[model samples]
Target: MGTNRWKKYKIEMLPIKEPTEIEELSLENLVDQILNAKKLDPNADTTALEREIDQMVYQLYELTPEEIKIIEG
Candidate 1:
């Protein structure tokens, strides 16, 4: 039998969010989703998720072009 290294932690499959649903997520919810994604698969590619988070932040802050340029840099 394999060692139960994660015995104390409960593991369950997270629901996959559709693109439209993801687009409507609040910033706090989006952050939670990102954290859960990382918890589920640290090595998995999260570029798309990160991109969505960036988009949400940009919208929330309503940053100007100069601010965005500075932040992007």
Candidate 2:
């Protein structure tokens, strides 16, 4: 019963594949790519991503939430 419980609790590990192509870009380039892709894509996910980006940008730029709300309004 103990052995059976141990077997049942054992985790199966799967092989993980590393990505073949990974390109590292500057933060500016990354932001540009994200914004451009968001502009091109008209999906709900894209809009949500854009909103997240906007919040990050505002925080990084030291803009207040009130300022953002004003601009957004």
Candidate 3:
């Protein structure tokens, strides 16, 4: 029998840890936290999250740039 080029592999993944506490937070608050935290961590995806929030707010409230800036700031 010829040696197999591809070997069978078993991959073990680590279990994910859940947050210690679940707090009731609004989406806006969550996004704001993400944005602020991203300033410290380069890997955080705050920009994409912010864009999603922007789209959501536009659909729901039709917020202007000034209004959005005021909220975000």
Candidate 4:
């Protein structure tokens, strides 16, 4: 019988910890974060998470750039 190549290595698994609280961000903040991310990586491909967030935000509020600024102020 052939010896196992990885028999000497010991693997340790860490316990997963639950979050203390669920932090919620306003639509404005989410939009700002998404815009900043896009600006930072304009050539990057669009992600499913980003698309989902965009859809959620769009459904909740259909505000223009001007309106977003007004709300932020």
Top lDDT model = 1
Per-model lDDT = 0.69, 0.57, 0.61, 0.55
After aligning candidate 1 to the native by TM-score, how far in Å is the CA of 10 from where it should be? 43
Clashes of 4: 0
**Tens-digit lDDT string for candidate 2 (1-73):** 3554445335445333332232223334556767688688845255555676566566556678789998789
Q: After superposing candidate 1, which stretches have Cα over 4 Å from the reference?
A: 1-25
Q: Model 2 Cα RMSD, Å?
A: 17.9
lDDT of 4 by residue, 1-43 (tens): 8975543333234333332232125445556767777899976
**TM-score order of candidates, top first:** 1, 2, 3, 4
RMSD of each: 13.3, 17.9, 18.3, 16.5
**TM-score for all models, in order of appearance:** 0.49, 0.40, 0.33, 0.30
Best by TM-score: 1
TM-score for predicted model 3 compared with the true structure: 0.33
Ranked by lDDT, top first: 1, 3, 2, 4
At residue 5, what lDDT does model 4 achieve? 54
> Which runs of model 3 end up more than 4 angstroms from their true locations?
1-25, 32-36, 39-43, 62-73
What TM-score should be assigned to candidate 4? 0.30
- 1-73, model 3: which lDDT tens digit per residue? 8985553442234333332233224455777788688788968767766776566655456568888788778
